[model samples]
Target chain A: MSDTADLTFLQTLRRVLHQERQIESGTVIYNLPVPFGFRSS
Target chain B: MQFALTEDQTAVRDMARGFADEKIAPHALKWDEDKHLPLDVIREAAALGIGGIYIKDDVGGSGMSRFDAALIFEALATGCPAVSSFISIHNMAAWMIDGFGSLQQRRKWLPQLCTMEKVASYCLTEPGAGSDAAALRTRAVRDGDHYVVNGQKQFISGGGVSDIYVTMVRTGAEGAGGISALVIDGKTPGVSFGANERKMGWNAQPTRAVIFENARVPVAHRLGDEGIGFKIAMAGLDGGRLNIAACSLGGAQAALDKSLAYMKVRKAFGKRLDEFQALQFKVADMATELEAARTFLWRAAASLDAKSPDASMLCAMAKRFATDVGFEVANDALQLHGGYGYLSEYGIEKIVRDLRVHQILEGTNEIMRVIISRKLIEGAR
Candidate 1:
């Protein structure tokens, strides 16, 4: 709603994007695909 | 995944903060008013390994990372943005030499530069070419073992005061491809500096036009091969952009801190400013935006460290966003201070002024957008 809230949301989104990109490219620690709605054991 | 500073990074930041508090903050206003460059204080910072924060340890540097440098510059800027920004420019120039210079060149130049015994200036912008840097007109013609350099560089930060200049000169053709990088000794014959230019901010450091009239620079001083100066300069800008943005962040953070202090004590309408909900909301926005900018800057710095393909675009994004937000937040901090902020002694106005040029220099925010969009377009294709 506000610029502050917008930036916070954007930052969270960026982190998620970075995480997804790293996972897709196999740069992250885990090698398995992170399935949607799949909770880690 | 790392959202916080490492212990070492925090220690470095604290060290720089202590130095700024002791040596820089008290005299910042006087330095700005008198247009003084505190060479002694800078040398002291050099003693603390602040001079070569990210340069290699082999050449008397601290061998820190770009991320570490971001923390250092931001901390130093909390004392005075102008001085901190000058140090940033010096580091950029030194890094260009370390990154591209031959072993002999590095051995000769970097040692003194790392110690701040001989300060360095990056000479690229010309009277005709600010935004369009490739169009720079400074010429260097090959003459025996030396290149006869002849042209002027405009708005050089350490123009007259710096001991060496990392200069870009056109050697062959009409465009960027013909340009070559040369290290020119400050006292070289025909090397002269124009009168220091009066500027709106960053007055703590001198800004002047560097003039060269047939100054002979030895061929040995050249960085990399001829025809690659533009690439070198552009590479340097990747890190330079991050440092300048960090400086902006520091200045804004200082202003915000001051505003918080002012609001706590300064009463208005029989109530302290912090008690007002509207003003508190404004403070909230300032802190939020500042934090967001800081986080983005760290991402950019990390990208640079990892040599990521998107490093340049991310740097451009961070620079544009952080500098704009820095100025806005600092300006808002001033607004929160009311009329007191406008006065010189309050220091918030100085932060606002110093952060203004961060948007203009290091490739204007307009150029930043162009760089970002071009990358996006290219990536899509």
Candidate 2:
């Protein structure tokens, strides 16, 4: 591939890379494991 | 605070897990027994864009974040920590070049490194200096247009087989500020590699001493300014520690998964092994510890991505906690397997052996404690 195409591809990857969610001040919710024998029937 | 992974992150993790399961898991034992590097398998991973997972795509990388890299590495390590750790080392090398090297140097090396066509090795630890890296004795004296480098780097993965070595050499005086990073071609004259050192684990990758005897390297190959090599190496270690910790997490998790499967089937004097209270407690503890380690690792990785003030401390804490817990979890899994875990065919023994080194390399767990205590004391004042 040409250098320009390579540049474009990398640029796209950079954009995608930095696109991850950034948590600010809300409560960080974790889906903790359910306790043993505590499952609702 | 969002603990859930985004679709892209989850997709990356799944892709890595699938690749590790299919391409690496089956051959792990054979490769370990043969002491083979499996270059082809590693290159296949490169095809998945892992070679430059965090490097910019312009430089032929995936340009992912450190958190993404950590998740992917944990998934990959479910196959084999030895192979995954080697890939982590290579990624560290790639990141160093891209982060510290000039635009010209990045253009020259990043593409090949990102593709794994030219495997890279980081040369930092010397015979006498492992944790105390700044006191290295490798010398690189300035010549007309080149520097005559003469030194030895110990315990370097991909030592002999790699195409490039990102070497740390003493250029100025006697401290961290006097060091320099050089990108030396592996085939350079007088640049020889010692035979691979036989070790207890990590057999799928080669580790050797990189010896330089009056090797002349061009000045243009140096990364960053003079006397900044220590800084560059330390920066790489922050990420390196996380990746190694992630490897341990993956291996321990795999062992736990295997133990869970085995316990459900293999029975003792009772109905089933999992029916026993003691074994269930062990299972519960292992799962909980592994999850805690994973959570801390993710937080540390994200801190590194954000370049937070406590990033280094977080990395050290994560490495220390995760590796120790990982080893404990793997050991418990082995005990749960009874005698079968000790055998090679079961693969639990291999995981235990491989996880053993994570506590030692990339700065020992003891050194991690030192870093953490120092940070804590300073923060208190």
> Which pairs of residues collide in model 2?
A10-B57, A10-B58, A28-B1
DockQ of each: 0.02, 0.08
| Candidate 2 lDDT over residue span B1-381, tens digit each | 899987557756776787788889999999999999999988877866788878876678887899989988898899999999999999999999999988899999998888798899999999999999899999999999899999899999999999999999999999999999999999999999999999999999999999999999999999999999999998999999999999999999999999999999998996799999989998999999999999999999999999999999999999999999989999999999999999999999999999999999999999999999999999999
Candidate achieving the largest DockQ = 2
Q: Which candidate is the best by TM-score?
A: 2
Error of 1 at B341 (Å): 0.5
Worst 10 residues of 1 chain B by lDDT: B6-15
- CAPRI verdict (incorrect, acceptable, medium, high) for model 2: incorrect
Off by over 4 Å in 2: A1-41
Once fitted onto the true fold, the runs of candidate 1 whose alpha carbons sit more than 4 angstroms away are A1-41
Query: Interface RMSD, candidate 1?
Result: 17.7
Output DockQ, candidate 2: 0.08
Q: For model 2, what is the alpha-carbon lDDT of residue A35?
A: 17
- TM-score of only chain B in every candidate structure: 0.99, 0.99
